[model samples]
Every structure is written in structure tokens, then in C-alpha cells.
Target: MSEINKVKVFRVQGTGPTPVTVKISRIGKALRIKCDCPAGAYMDPCEHWKSLFTGEDQNYLDITDDEIREIQDWLDDSDLDEALQNLLYFEGHEKNMHENLARQKRALRGRVIDILISDPQL
Candidate 1:
């Protein structure tokens, strides 16, 4: 069978005393990215994974630049790429989505959580 199921865990700096776990899983067609921090465990996307995917390296205080670049490159090649791109696009152009703002936000959150809670190939 074609290889598609995969998971990558990153020890991200910031958000707490120790590094946090940021997991990116590709199960079937969904890309479920999760963070173990308080906010993330509740299905909210914390700045830990958000900053990593959003390329906000300067916001980091503990990780090295090389580590940041590695995560960036890895995410760029992973299934999360499309999701990240979609998120970036949505954030940048959502002003045009005027009336659909709340609905879109809810849809994105539910879709992401649903993907994460589903059975995993791993």
C-alpha cells in the first residue's frame, strides 16, 4: 500500500517550564496537529504549534534557529503543509469572508478536532 500514515513529534520551546509536545499526524486525508499544552489539550491551537507552523521564529526564546528551520522545512513537506497554508490564507483574507467569519471558525475547529479524534493508522 502507498505510504501515507505518519506522525512527527516536536519538542517545542516556550509555553511552560519544559518543552511541550507538538504532534502532527497524517491519518488518511486528514492532517491532525495537536499540542499537549493546556490550551491545546482543549482542542484549541496554542501558540506553540501555531508559531512553529506560522514561521514565527522570533517569538521563540529557547529553541535554536536551526531547530526552527528544521520544523519549518519538515512541515512544508508534510501533509500539514496544505492545512497550514489554508490557515494562513484564511487568517489573511478572512476579512473578505465578512459574514461567514464565525461559521468558518467553528468549521475549522470542528474539522480539525474531528480529524484528530479519528482512528489512526499509526
Candidate 2:
């Protein structure tokens, strides 16, 4: 069996009364992530998207362990995986240098946003 295409859908609890949906899918060699939040509507990778990768979205996520593994696998196969690792590495080593860390975050954030907007499903 082959995992040719992968998809994960999450209904995350947000500020609104109802939860919003964040859809992540693998398209060829690119990733397509979509969220129904304001930031996502503008093609921004909102906290919803980031938290999913960071595992900080557990409280808001209504998914099973198997689904979690699937998402992790999807991320592991994407370029964002390397970017996230770099971001984490910098975060740990640049704590004392707040100014430098801020700059690094901005630069890395731009790359992540660019990746998010690269292959919009719409």
C-alpha cells in the first residue's frame, strides 16, 4: 500500500461560538492548508495551523491519536518540517538575544507564510 495523498481535517474551537475547520492536505510535492479563521481567509497560516504542528492545539482539537499520527506524518514529509526544526533550534539558542531572536522569527515566519500561500486550493 502507498500513502500517495494524505488529508487531515480539524474542527478547532476558536473565539467564535462555533468551531472552525482547518484542512491540511498533500498535493503532489506541496502542502495545502486551509482554515476558516480570518487570518486563514487571507491565506495566512494562523495560530490554528501553527498550533497543530506545535501540539499546542490539543485542548482545542477534537481528534483521535491515529489522526494525530497522520498529521505528524504529513508534516514530516513537507518542507515546513525543516523550517520548523530551524525555528525551534533558534528559539532554544537565541533566548538571551531578544533582538536577534525577533529578527529570526520574522524571517522564518515569512518563509512559513510563503509556504502556506504557495499552493492555495482556491
CA RMSD per model (angstroms):
17.1, 16.1
User: TM-scores of the models, in the given order?
Assistant: 0.50, 0.61
- Predicted candidate 1 versus true structure: per-residue lDDT over 1-122, tens digit per residue: 67456666767667468777777666665567787888887988677777766666534545567766655665645666786788778875875777578889988999888888894952
For all candidates in order, the CA lDDT equals: 0.70, 0.75
Model 1 / residue 8 / CA error / Å: 0.9
lDDT of model 1 at position 3: 49
**How many residue pairs clash in all the candidates, one count each?**
0, 0
The candidate 2 region of ten consecutive residues with least summed lDDT is 52-61
Looking at model 2, residue 4 earns an lDDT score of 43
Tens digit per residue, CA lDDT, model 2, 17-81: 88889888885556678999899989876767677666664345677777767777777767567
